[model samples]
Target: MHRNQGLYNYLNEHSWQITEDWYKLVNDEDSESIYSTTDPEIIQSLKEQNQDYFQHLHKLFIEKEEDFFRDFKIWSEELAKDQKHLKTPVQYVVREFMNSQEVYMKYLKEYFSLNKDNVALDQFLSWIDLVRRVVNLSIYIYIEEANRNTLRQLIAQKEIINELSSPVILLRKKIALLPLIGDIDTARAKIILENTLSQCADLRIEDLCIDLSGVAIIDTMVAHEIFHLIQALKLIGVRSTLCGIRPEIAQTAIQLGLDFSHIRTTATLSQALDRIIAD
Candidate 1:
């Protein structure tokens, strides 16, 4: 059994060489990727980040497996959160990781050829395995973090759309209009309920006209949410009128055993507005 002291020394000494070789072959032509940037600062930052990754990865040759991976996680997270890397398409990032891995493997083979008499075959294979693990773990962590970023953005966008879709436009002093549009799923229905109540309270609305004419579909859950919204408004001392109820929506509301006896109903938004003005 041969100690891999020589392998470790070689990797540490020539780490920068590995980074340079990897950068030379990096495929950065993708228009949508951050790698395609022409800014010299961004290009230099990319090089520094890649070199840092190599700095953490090559320590696997001398450090305990647990310690190596622990440090690698930190590096992977920083890379994942780097604004530039995050903007780069994940597939392109993955391709570059593989390219860097190839560079390391090439260097390892070079080192082996030069010290073939001193390095054992099994030690060489073990080193290969360690290098592969480092690259694989790096890819795994980066992808995981990227997915989390994507999910957060989606949630934020959904919240914004929900807030905009259920806006309470002020018609007059203490009078507001909520014109529901698009299909309403349970999730969106919940947001609508919360936002409508909040906006009405904020505007100190006395009467709210909820128009559903532009709404394409209102499933059982959504119909129930609308009912709850009117009920919630009454609790806040805000009166609500149902307007522009399409025939299908009306049927769905009726079929769901929704009680609207105490609520005011109108055939169109104009009629609802007229009634609000009269009151």
Candidate 2:
């Protein structure tokens, strides 16, 4: 109540103008309230009170923003624990909220105690609604990424699932070492191709080493798809050298009568690295 009296004083002093939010808080609702009904003595007192309110509220926000995040981190964690166990970064939460272009005109009006005017309040309310939507979208992104990561883990758990090596860089070159861990279908192969190609442009990578030591088998169609990826990379100025081909996988290539068709094949990553270095 005292704080309100202080804010009222401050608003009255400025003719209801809110400087920070550019809102004429005092004059926004009614100038008559201060000068028409109230005496000059009462108006003078209100000004003094509002000055105190401004100082206190400014201090409060400075203190509270830090605490709000700390509390939010704790609260979000608690909420996540009771849910399906999806944990997201608090950084994401705060960033999404802070950068969210949502400014609450309504919140400003309410904070200023200009509640009687619905038209002015609507503008602020609309701003709040916009920010809320942006925050929700940001959250969705975090949740989706978390779920994708979980799915990737599950897939990697099966012994039959082959793990592809991440693209290793060498000699200012991108050597995509697809050391097949388990299996290679058109789908996984497509993912590997996309991942490797994505790195090529950024890294200015020249050599791509597609290793297949952990992979034991490949159908003719898969082989053709691999050939296509190499060709595509070659067209984009990325030289692909398929490395770490286990003997069994080589035999599959031979038994299936799969022609590599200009795709460079190597026995090991060491050999591939050495060759790229020599080049």
The candidate maximizing TM-score is 1
In model 1, where do residues sit more than 4 Å from their true spots? 1-3, 251-261
**Where does the lowest 10-residue lDDT sum fall in candidate 1?**
1-10
Report the Cα lDDT for residue 267, model 1: 97
lDDT of 2 by residue, 1-279 (tens): 112333334334543233323222232123323312245675555444434333333232233444534544444344333222233344433342343222233333455465444334554454355335434543555565556666766877732332234454444435544454566677777776776677776777777777777776688877877787888888899888888877887788888898875677677888888887788
Per-candidate local distance difference test: 0.86, 0.53
Model 2, position 35, has a per-residue lDDT of 19
lDDT of 2 at 265: 69
Q: Report the C-alpha lDDT of model 1 over 166-189, residue by residue, as the tens digit.
A: 999998899999999998888888
How many Å off is the CA of 116 in candidate 2? Answer: 54
TM-score of each: 0.92, 0.41
Question: When superposed on Cα atoms, how far off is each prediction in RMSD?
Answer: 2.0, 17.7
- TM for candidate 1 is 0.92
